[model samples]
Target: MKMTDDNKEIIFNNITKWLRDSNFVMSEEKITVVTSEFYAKAYLQSDHEYILEIMSATGIETRFALRIRLPVSEQQLENYENLEPKEKLIFDDKMNAVIFPQRQSINIKEKSAFLEKTISIDPKSIDAKQEVMQNISNLLGSAKKLEISFDELLSN
Candidate 1:
């Protein structure tokens, strides 16, 4: 899934437009272009204070990832993973309460105060990439409502 600089640039622009269409504000400074021999990344932010990161592998890695940050913890993630009656909505202020209902997860990587879910994408085909992006955009749309709710919890 290694991507060329040109391909990365094209994808970045398309994602920018998608974010705008979603009514997210991508300030000039919030859209960062980062590239190295092993990776190319786009770090984006919105007026709502949500951040989205898109990464492409430029080395031996066979996949890219789309991730977003969430305020969550490792113990909380473990509990979510261990859910027996997953259909039940159990929320705690310390968990990713908003995303739990959607069955989405935060891949707890040294979960501190924040964690994220990384969805890998096979970037070998343009269609696959497009589909993945569309899927993420759709998910983002759905998550917006819960994100606001989570924000209120934090404010309390």
Candidate 2:
């Protein structure tokens, strides 16, 4: 409840364990804890990796927030942008991710694009782990659907 170091550490440890139990590969050495945040890298597969950042503060309505970022390619960004309005809407309906485009001022190329999704966890909830896992599963499924949609668009 209080954003103390001990509470943060406990939550981080629990989340790390949950992730490992769910078959996410992570190295303990890669985990970082700052004063107000915890960061970790998780790999669902060799190619599918995500950055997990958890943050808590005093005044925020959501006591604990977990942000997951999955990197995508420039091609994926292009394909997503080219989708028809209705198709885009359908994708939005299925995925709870915000597409972020990264570009350099000189090059102006969409080289690094990513999907980011945030989940708020009530630390007191008995089903917090289940909720987090379900969110992850849904996110992965949507990512797969996105890939299929890109392939379909390419074919057409």
Candidate 3:
């Protein structure tokens, strides 16, 4: 549970490599790896049925949202959707990243803006962080006709 500096570096290297392997280029600054809060309900309806509600003591969404300035296809978006229900992500066309554990931001013009130099991790990392957590939630699911709650989606 205690991650030493060396251990952190190792994880960081792994994370960085995975991100690059996923076609995300990295910058020399503002790169971080940290645990993210569960924003699951932030994007889910109270009535929506998901293994997330069934398996974890915390229903809060610890999902990852990567900011990318790249134009993503509906198919690319679907790939993240097919991820485990617990693994949620919202990619921005203004930011680019392969993965980071949580979201990071910067204050700009008196408004909080996503740091241009940051990269957030993907939800699939949960399988590495906690297999039991990944197992409880369905990962190998379908994204065909994905159902999204507009209210939940926009609330984030």
RMSD of 1: 7.2
Using lDDT, rank the candidates from best to worst: 2, 1, 3
The sequence of per-residue lDDT tens digits that candidate 2 reaches over residues 10-57 is 766777789889878765323344544556666664545555444453
- Identify the leading candidate in terms of lDDT: 2
In model 2, the worst 10-residue window by lDDT is 100-109
Clashing pairs in 1: none
Q: Which is the winner by TM-score between candidate 1 and candidate 2?
A: 2
**Stronger candidate by TM-score (1 vs 3):** 1
lDDT string for model 3 (58-111, tens) is 112322322212222444445544545554434321212321222333222221
Candidate 3 contains a number of clashing pairs equal to 16
Considering only N, C-alpha and C atoms within 3 Å, which residue pairs clash in candidate 2? none
Instruction: Give TM per candidate.
Output: 0.44, 0.61, 0.28
Q: Which ten residues in a row have the lowest lDDT in candidate 1?
A: 36-45
Local distance difference test scores for all models: 0.48, 0.55, 0.29
Which ranges in model 3 have alpha carbons more than 4 Å from their true place?
A: 29-109, 115-126, 129-156
What's the CA RMSD for each of the models?
Answer: 7.2, 6.9, 16.0
Candidate 1 residues lying further than 4 Å off, grouped into runs, are 1-3, 27-49, 60-63, 73-105, 111-133, 138-156
